[model samples]
Target: MSEPDPGLSSGAVVAEPETLHAPPPRLSSPLARLALDFCASRPAVAGLAVILVVAVAAIFAPLIVPQNPYDLAQLDIMDGTLPPGSPSYAFGTYWLGTDVQGRDMLSAIVYGLRISLLVGSVSVAFALVIGSAVGLVAAFFGGGLDSLLMRIVDIQLSFPAILVALILLAIFGNGVDKVIIALVIVQWAYYARAVRGSALVERRKEYIDAAVCLGLGTRRVLFGHLLPNCLPPLIVIATVQVAHAVALEATLSFLGVGVPITEPSLGLLIANGFEYMMSGRYWISFFPGVALVVVIVAINLVGDRLRDLLNPRLQR
Candidate 1:
């Protein structure tokens, strides 16, 4: 053994070897953390990419697609039902072909996606607002009012969402606004139940008691104090519900009780092509069906990943 340095004090202690550990990467904000979490999963990233592509196509359909599927003046009846890759006299190459009305399949699919997303998003927003309000009021009060509200939710929940939507549509007649209203009525019950559950737990927390003790109004106590804490699960539900609303709207449209003929959706496009499937005109329905599946699957992937990311138990 080597002798210790003579200059060192008897009570002095030598330092241990330093371990070479890298510092954690800095996350600038909550959004940055969410972005990192989202990118950590390859499937979620791919789903997001697909959603972005479809959304972009839908948003810029008129600029990108060669023909305007919705414009009567742009269509030529002679070109109707052209097969994929067929040559069009008016628009050069019809890459995805034309429908029965001589509308380009690609353009129609993009426009249909636009309509589906629009209805889905708007209905979800309306449902969230209506449901959250009902849930907050019920949970915050916790009395006969809660019992009455909950019984209504229970009755609505007993029926299938599609069945309820169909019944409402039957009574209201078919149109975009009517379809949205039907979807909201069908979906609000779900959000109401979810929000009420979350609010029930949150209402007992210290912050909620403090807010109440501060003489905050009922609106402030429910909306401001309780609602924010209950939002994580609501966000996850909203993402999944939007996909549900889209599929439900498509089903209603396919059954001839959804959007009007003037405003076509993927469901309507598929329905239009159903009669010709026995012939060789498969591309009409096939392409639209694929688009619908892709949109639904992509949204589901994102929603599932969000559920995992947001849930603490799942994180463990």
Candidate 2:
């Protein structure tokens, strides 16, 4: 038995020493907590940093680059094929060299990234909206409607996405809008399939039954309830698909069925430099290719991290 201390005499009030515990970690809001979790992964953090820098550069291309590659007045013919760090007669130094058209590689890449991101993001958003609606309607109705939609999705998915995009582009002709249309056409099926699977699982859950039983409108239950719950996987897919859309667009542009020559994306820039690759002038294609790779890899990294973060089964 523990001996009573002399300081604690009979009839005297004695205070017990409090046990110190680290205060329970304060619960943060979801967004803040998500940010913190994302930051905890080094690769994700690095990828996000790269994406932010590239996005900012692309957004402010005109202000960041020495010259606008699009403006004919800014290009000097004699400056064509200048190596990286070579000084131009009119446009100061060519940091990443020049293409066959005397367009600054750096400027072209920055501008091209802007276009690529715009097309990819817009196409993905469109696909997401279309796909989600289709999936929700299918899952909610089930039976014949679900079978019909799934069959269409299966038929679409059976074909390679790039090949589908190529065919669509060939039919639509070359332009930014056309390329986006092609991409969205090829891409939406994947989202529909994904959303349908998730929605199916969620449809079987108790809350969905409750919502259905409560006489909720189809729009309210599907969009307001089912759609939000299905978003995690859809978000992961969208993030990764942005990279695919950019790559597909680049491929189409490289193949000459993408954006018109008047507007160059990274692929067009690479195609322009293809002839020069044998001539030892590599900066034009090489730099743009590197930029595209960086963008895709960074996006994939972020997507992978998000998948791991959002999927309980994948959590460490």
Candidate 3:
């Protein structure tokens, strides 16, 4: 049989040591694969879905809401404080019920989400930009610069974030911009520490040496290579920080320092409803309270998962 057809023989295939010596099929980078795997996982996917729904509702509040909360013409004082399941104020008409100001609670929550999201997103952005820049510079050029930046971070960390926010808000006076300023000031140190730690490690990598050998500019290496690599941790930090920022904004609003009285945020709604709690209008604060709790919990769940996913050491 032609010498047992060596090429087709099982023994011949098994004896090809070269095949075993050949490198295993190239796998994708660990970071990229990890990110893809996390996104594909059920909990992360569901978290994203919930976030999208909330975002869409907030974005299209005007069109989605039955009554415009801000429009004086549409709001009737008679409709104010109507409990759930009331006639004339049907389930569809005042779904979340109305506030003391006669504003649709559903609409108010939608609009409030817009404000909260905006402030939270902007503050996080501000923190990321400022912190990353400081950390990058400090890590790239150690000594005095690192010491100074780290000292600032340490000093800031020494104080409670709320206390710092309170001091800044007190100085700036209460407004949306001022609230954002306070949040940024209070939040950037966390980002700076995270980025600094990441940058320190990335700066020592062989690729960084290769980039330097290629005569690529320092800014290019720091931003293009180092920064991108640092983003995974930063992203995890940002998600958690956003929840904190939202809660901080609510706390400020509750304390009467966040978004003015003219614009009612969720905290303002809760603060206003506090008085009516004893009057048996439980729906006033209860609904908003529930909404806030749900949002914070959802965000925290997502953030915690992301943190674990990104850190292999944390994996069970």
Which candidate number would show the highest TM-score if scored against the true structure? 2
Q: Give candidate 2 misplaced runs (Cα > 4 Å).
A: 1-20
- The CA lDDT at 129 in model 2 is 92
Judged by whole-model lDDT over C-alpha atoms, candidate 2 comes out at 0.91
Give one digit per residue, the lDDT tens place, for model 3 in 51-94: 78888988898888777677788778888898765544432567
Cα-based lDDT at residue 122, candidate 1: 97
RMSD of each: 4.0, 4.0, 4.8
Residue 218 displacement (Å), model 1: 1.7
Predicted candidate 1 versus true structure: per-residue lDDT over 1-316, tens digit per residue = 9987876778878665555455676998987899899999999999999989988988888888887788899989888899999998877888887889898998899999988999999999999999999999999998999999999999999999999998999999989999999999999998999999999999888998898898999888887779998998999999999999999999999999999888969999999999989999998899999999999999999999999988889989
Candidate 1 lands at a TM-score of 0.92
Q: How does each model score on TM-score? A: 0.92, 0.93, 0.86
Rank by lDDT, descending?
Answer: 1, 2, 3
Q: Which candidate do you rate higher for lDDT, 1 or 3?
A: 1
List where candidate 1 sits over 4 angstroms from the true fold: 1-22
Candidate 1 worst ten-residue window by lDDT: 14-23
The positional error of residue 26 in candidate 2, measured at the CA in angstroms, is 3.1
C-alpha lDDT of all candidate models, in order: 0.91, 0.91, 0.85
